[model samples]
Target: MELAIADKITQKPAIKRNVYENVTQQFNKASDLMDLDPDIRKILATTTNEIIVHFPAIMDNGRIEMFTGYRVQHNNVLGPYKGGLRYHPAVDIDEVRALATWMTWKCAIAGIPFGGAKGGIAFDPSKHSFGEMERITRRFTYALNGNIGPEYDIPAPDVNTNSQIMAWILDTYLSSVTPQERNRSIHIVTGKPIASGGSQGRDKATGQGTVFCIEQWAKDKNFDLNNATYMIQGFGNVGSWAAKLLKPFGSKLVAVEDHTGAISNPEGIDPDKLAIYVKERKGVHGYPAAEPVDHESFFKTKADIFIPAALENQITAETAPLLNVKLVAEGANGPTDIEGDGILQEKNIDLLPDILCNGGGVIVSYFEWLQNKRSESWELEEVDERLRKKVINAYKKVKNTSQEFNTDWRTGAYIVALSSIQEVYRTRGIFP
Candidate 1:
């Protein structure tokens, strides 16, 4: 069965559009171009399973609130379902489905043996106390029981979630499993603390991987980073680190935006100072150096490159037309929807697809997974080198494919990923 049909059967109506729909649309476009078999395309479009769990947790206000959690297993044809676990008030099954689908393509682009899946609980972690957060994570972990395994589905960190949440999940899962299953506890999850078997370089792996790709892209395009002007949307881990790394290249950091608001300075902002302020003050809104700007007007800023590191759907068709940047590096998943992509294409703006662009995190997660399985620790320098090679190779493959097809990078990326997935399906054949 095609994946899309399966998705329609499983998905409920009146829900926010599945983020994967954007992914599926891109896949279908490439599938049509390739004249792929309908059945195979369908199989690739839908998720294998979608698990939703609702549980009650005591709130700090002495109220028992029913929190809903979800895990969508998009595919396991390549390997285990590998993605991140998130915590946010707006998390829903559709979002997980979309995120899971992106994971499928990301791993394929990296030439890694991993499928896609994503899990999340609908709650604002920032509003909860530490004890409350732990309890919520533990309960969510408990609900999974034995459904999650190192060889089945592996979850990392995403959105409002982090390594601390993964730690709680690991402990909860370990306590619930049998003694025989406990030996492989470390393998069951990635993004834990170093002492708890997390990979040494996992913390900065995503940002570093992104830097490697950007550097390589600059080299291939003959674009000098020293003269490039950057406007980043999202000052979180990925954006902040990317800014810091690019600073040494003599790039001008023109502007940056977060949930609080956007801030800009045409002369360029110091990444080190911005990092310190964001670290100490929690956001970049109150930084005294840069002038406060309205978030709505951020798209109009003229710059060489715009990196969207925030949540998905930030740049729609409406916003795409307003963007004045020459290049867009998607540091977030599904930041550009299909319609928005069309506008960007019409405008001839270069777009770096999320599956290939922001895939550093999961690629590093794979490294983390391998380290745990081998019970070995690698040096940070080694980790950085390995990650750089992987990203560069992946970028090269995508670039070559784009040239071969004479299409934009986004379609070329889809073609490359879909071709791999189609080959996998053809080799596996049909199951009874």
Candidate 2:
């Protein structure tokens, strides 16, 4: 059964889209709106550094396989470079560049002291055993030795990478330094196990932050979360956490679609139970709580809110028209393409753009970094409180900007971020 599941996971259809192009397109739209300085626009348009590495790792079968990895630093004017380390077969330069650029905007909108960077290894983590994964991760970390650090560039987890992978990275990076520098260097990675200096609420920070944005939206619109039905397009960390946290607000997760399959229950599905089933079964495919649905039906399912927590370009021009929801809270970066954004706007479906909607993860990541830097551990309650305050503040800013410009949420978010970045550049001026 597990083998069958693994095979199913690996058989996903190919999705082709230039994510970097998407980022630049959005940037150009916001830049035109704000009349951004052409010089600064040109500077922000390109990456600061693009590091690619190829290394060999021994598999459990004693076969040596070469792997490729990338770390793209987009900008660091605000602070040190910060982003996630993803592991996926589709990992490439364009995707990393787009995500890194998004991180710059995300951190700026969230008012965090960090710039943008992203790293990824182009391999399917599920195909490898624990030992093989450890070797590959350690080798990748070694390859990125000087490029990543506590005060320079920090890597967190994204997509197929998780806390365990981050733990490997933290250890491998620490092993290269002296004993005196070991404890302080644990900050090199943010999403490690709590025992390894990770923040208490880091695991659910992204999801919790998503819910906070939704809560603020609900409050402003006078929409009651109680009895609201939502469909989630991914059941991974962010999606599952959002569902679980929304349970308290009486939100019903009526439908869910993931890499494995889609399922729906009109009455409601228990997010906690489904999350457990997914953990054990590797997806939401075999969950008995909901009837199986196809991709089209999953999106067309009548619901109050839709959260695309899956990979990029899921909600495209084609899928946008099929959606039957009032709000879309982007849980994944770049889930909605440019055309889809226009379609959603035409449909009057309010959207919480990815940069603002998913900014919680980085905001909390900033908190974790501060905790490690200051040699302090915060309670989960404190972390949650801080995350709530920061996320709400960002949401308010985006909302105000949207109303101020009479534009959609995505452009509004970009304008807010670009204005902040432009202010910094104007104040600091360019270096020789």
Candidate 3:
């Protein structure tokens, strides 16, 4: 279906390839391996809608600046479109499309009754003032007025975005609806502040879920979690919370690399202290307990586990060879590209694929949505217990699928997701 278009410009191959291509490659492998139904494959191959909005917002200095925002609805056959909205400089159509597609697979793997969608504004949140950020967030919400709804498309928090941003979006959306619908519409978004209907333990859900999968792996391998050493990339919510949650299991954080710098402390850098330091210094650069190290040194720091909680394509062919870990628990989406994936398989590095490993966030997001809709609020302990069960179940499913197909965990995850979609389409049949 390639259309005749304008002449294309040729350039050198990129070291860090396009994220969308990486995701598509992963999908193609699973589709081929399983002999996926052609009709369902076609439906899953493309997005339902791609919305790019350009709007103006008033800056703190009284100047109106234009911002480009995107929301790609990948699929909604299972239920509604559910994913996160991240505010990062790297936000673009291709990246959002990849993220949206991953969400589809993620939810399907987790057995959550939600499809996939993702959106974000392409700008640096750090450079913006509070007022400016609020105006930008609300403006994006207004621009997406009818396109998003509680039961239709629910947006959660992602990279550089948090409960506060979700709060702003919720308020803006509730105000736009009819007065009678305001109460019912509180479920329009997840990851809201607790007082605003956010689920308890939602803040650390992703990290909790990552640790749960790691625990499952440890049990399967007959390895103990007590006093295990690990390294992490990215000091944001997911990485920090994962480190903190692992503390109870006697897991130690040995080395960490963030955007600011990489630091290592063989004696173990305290997760709580590092978290506090990150909040004050805005990065992990000047932690007094750890020594600053180069990228190679950080990757080479011998440890039992490696968690890449940063951006996409981080563990490429070059970086993959340097990793010295038994397992990789991806707290972030698409952290490993196709080449790196091959390298890891060659090295026998057990991988907890992003879809199965980092599904806690969305699973908890589903909990939050259910709570809001049912007019219920769950306690922290209850939330934690429920998340543990859901994530472990998903972990078992992925492992079983991998074994059944004699394929990698990533492909196993994809097969699980594709099968779910295919079953639904087959049972219901396509619309006329």
On lDDT, the candidate that comes out on top is 3
Best to worst by lDDT, what's the order?
3, 2, 1
* Top candidate, metric TM-score: 3
Question: Which residue runs does candidate 3 get wrong by more than 4 Å?
Answer: 1-17, 53-68, 87-92, 121-136, 159-161
Give the least accurate 10-residue stretch of model 2, judged by summed lDDT: 1-10
Stretches of candidate 1 exceeding 4 Å from the true structure = 1-15, 53-68, 88-91, 122-136, 176-181
lDDT per residue as tens, model 2, 1-432? 222211222244445345545666777788898899988887787788989999999998888999999999989999999999999998987678778888898899999989999989999988999999999999999998899999999999887888999999998999999999998887898887888888888778889999999999999999999999999999998999999999999999999999999999999999999988999999999799899999988989999999999898888888999999999999987899888988999999999999899888888889989999999999999999999999988899999988998888899999999999899899999986
Candidate with better lDDT, 2 vs 3: 3
TM-score of each predicted structure versus truth: 0.89, 0.88, 0.89
The local distance difference test score of each candidate is 0.83, 0.89, 0.90
Candidate 2 off by > 4 Å: 1-16, 54-68, 88-90, 122-136, 286-289
List model 3 lDDT by residue over 1-432, tens digit each: 631101010121464246657667778899899899987887787788889999999999999999999999989999999999999997887668767887898899999999999999999999999999999999999998899999999998878888899999999999998999999999999988889998998879889999999999999999888988999999898999999988889988999999999999999999999999999999999899999999999999999999999888899998999999999999998899999999999999999999899889889989999999999998999999999999988888889999999999999988988888999999999888
How badly does each model clash, as a count of residue pairs?
Answer: 7, 0, 0
Alpha-carbon RMSD to native, per candidate: 3.1, 6.7, 3.3
- Model 2 RMSD to the real structure? 6.7
User: Residue 48: error of model 3 in Å?
Assistant: 1.0
- Tens-place lDDT per residue, model 1, 1-432, is 443633663466656555556776777677777778888776776788989998887877888878899999988888888988988888877778777877888888877789989999988888889989988888888887766888899988877887788888888888887888786667788888888888766756666777777888888889999969999998888898888888999999898999888899999999899999999999998898888888667888899889898888888977998999878888877789888898998998887888888778887788888888887788888888888888888888889988888887887888888788889888989976
